[model samples]
Target chain A: MNSAAGFTSQDSATRISVGDALTPEDVSASSAVAAEDTARYALMLGDDCLILAQRLGNWISRAPELEEDIALGNIALDLLGHARFFLTYAGSAWGKSEDDLAYFRDEEDFRSCRLVEQDNGDFGKTIARQLIFSFYTHELYSRLVDSADATLAAIADKALKEVDYHQDHAAQWLLRLGGGTAESSRRVQAGLDAAWPYVEELFADVEPTERLAEQGVAVLPSALREPVLDRLHAIITEAGLNPPEAKGAFGADRSGRFSEHRGFILAEMQVLARQHPGASW
Target chain B: MEETDRNAPTDQVPEGGVVTEDPAEHSVWPLWEVFVRSSRGLSHVHAGSLHAPDAAMALRNARDLYTRRNEGTSLWVVPAADITASDPDSKGGYFESPKGKSYRHATYYKQSEGVPHL
Candidate 1:
């Protein structure tokens, strides 16, 4: 809402204050398109966080160590927070609620990337998954905080802070397991190799991604790829390790394909909701 | 900061029976104690413990294990073995016996519950 910071020209012409900036009239024809685009992008992001939160949540009372169980639980809560904001925004565009977006949508209708839905394989694999996703999200959120849409910018700004902690958590685990005993180092490297092909999908330029970038509703994932890779390289170097080259063929439509791992993951994730209709805790 | 040149050996088993062993022989890492300062200009308070292979990794593990949800702004990690405590057997004779000494108590001379003469 502070025009001088990052508001679009179209937004600036309509209002002078934060509250006024969100008024219906201030959302221009182009801005409405941006909001629609924002909704779609938010769903994609919300699904990523939701799925990852589910995966991390499963680690509670089951982590390799007690300390790690609590740590992973906290990270899951942070991701859930991000999911809440993004899904709330998505629902707002359609005159719905966050609960409707999260509960009513079918699995096929979900827009998350496949990486998040893949099962939490091993402790090493989970850390590897977190390392890749957190770094990617951190870069995206950093650039997205400067978005032209006020609500999107606000969400991005808040998420960026949370994602920084998430990235640091993953980075620390990566260094520890990668540089430690031979078995740990080997296993963690194997996990990275398994996760690498999915990493490329994260940067692939897709239609929704392109449209959202044009309207200033989302940061282009491709633009953030370089910095994310550079950071990964630095962490790997610091850890005295190398990620194995990615194996397996690249799948089409990164968002469309779920690996062999997702079935079990979804069964566990959706079980409680499916079992209890309209249940409140 | 320069790495402190500790006269203390990096690999020796401490008096308390805490020892570091190669990963080939031992599966678990040595425990490290964590301290966190919640914000700038605050004293570090004892947080918890975690395990890691070395000091750098220990510090990192501390960050992840202790400060995940913005609970801390700064962290300090020390191998749990490095900390020395006075013996519990000595507590009764050495610590508790000294508590009642008149000179040490600040409240020995009580002030009235009013604006006191400075």
Candidate 2:
């Protein structure tokens, strides 16, 4: 519950103490003034992590095993930490706090991709989604460590280590479920097919992200598609599973327009917050 | 500490042909003991125990359970069965000698007070 380090008074007071929270001193003076594009870019990454964390949290007591419960819970907590930091930083651009942004925003106002918004179908399906997303995040965050924006770079530096472990967790699960039993292999393949269509939305070039990438404040999503896909392809092949040939969901915009599952997710997540505004435990 | 006969015969098993349970039939994973090193001065202390199928999963589980609050920099997970503990009944015989050995303590050397780095 340590206060996030580098944030100003205007930033959300949410306590997110993962690896050293970016203190105010960590952010360069030039990076203090967040551009409109930078804030929007942050929103995209933050929303993605926030929604995925919520989905992962659903597996706390319901995972296939107890050890898996702890594993998923840890990953969910780490994602929540990343989400809090990004949302706090993004909120600083306007007068909004993290709570105001997360709880008050409507479904269309969220900027997360369809990959994260997809429902956690089963253990295998969740693993499939995690494998894809974690691989993408690993590549994205690895590049983001060199960002011109110091705060973003610092966040990425801490996030990269966590994402590496997350990637390994998903990969291990994928291999086990893919090779363990005939029924398990079938379910895992089905899970991969179910989640494959949403992968394309993750690498789509959005205007705000593209603009920020030009300024060296963000990594370009389109630039990450090839390497991430290559790594995922290798993992899927090594797991003895056939790569799904399903077509990507077309023309789906992450900025406002979301998948059908997002509304239900938001309703569950934002319900208590919207119900009792300004109430604290 | 008092030493009991370590090779004492067990009375729990009677002479009658009683059914012995096989350990392999149990499907549960083996337990692992977790130790976490919090800082430079602190040794790896026993955090808790968890069940995992293998060493890799045990280490990962240890990380998830013990280090959630950023409590440690390093972790060590050993199979619970690998550890050997002294019999609690033999505590008196094992630990008795160190009790009155004030000469073994650095505080016993009172004349070294003026030393820079005793």
Clashes of each: 0, 8
> Model 2: residues >4 Å from true position, as ranges?
A1-19, A23-31, A255-258, B1-26, B87-118
Q: Candidate 2: deviation at residue A172, Å?
A: 2.2
For each candidate, give its TM-score against the true structure.
0.76, 0.81
Residue-level lDDT tens digits of model 2 in B13-98: 64454647554478677889999987778899898999887898788888888887767889999998899999989999999879
Residue A177, model 1: Cα distance from true site in angstroms? 2.5
Best by lDDT: 2
Using TM-score as the measure, the top candidate is 2
Clashing pairs in 2: A5-A23, A6-A22, A6-A23, A6-A24, B1-B92, B1-B93, B1-B94, B2-B93
lDDT of 2 by residue, A179-267 (tens): 87998888889989999998888888887887888888899988998999899999999999988878888765796464778899999
Predictions' DockQ, in order: 0.14, 0.30
TM-score of 1: 0.76
Clashing pairs in 1: none
Off by over 4 Å in 1: A1-34, A243-264, B1-26, B38-42, B47-53, B56-73, B96-99, B106-117
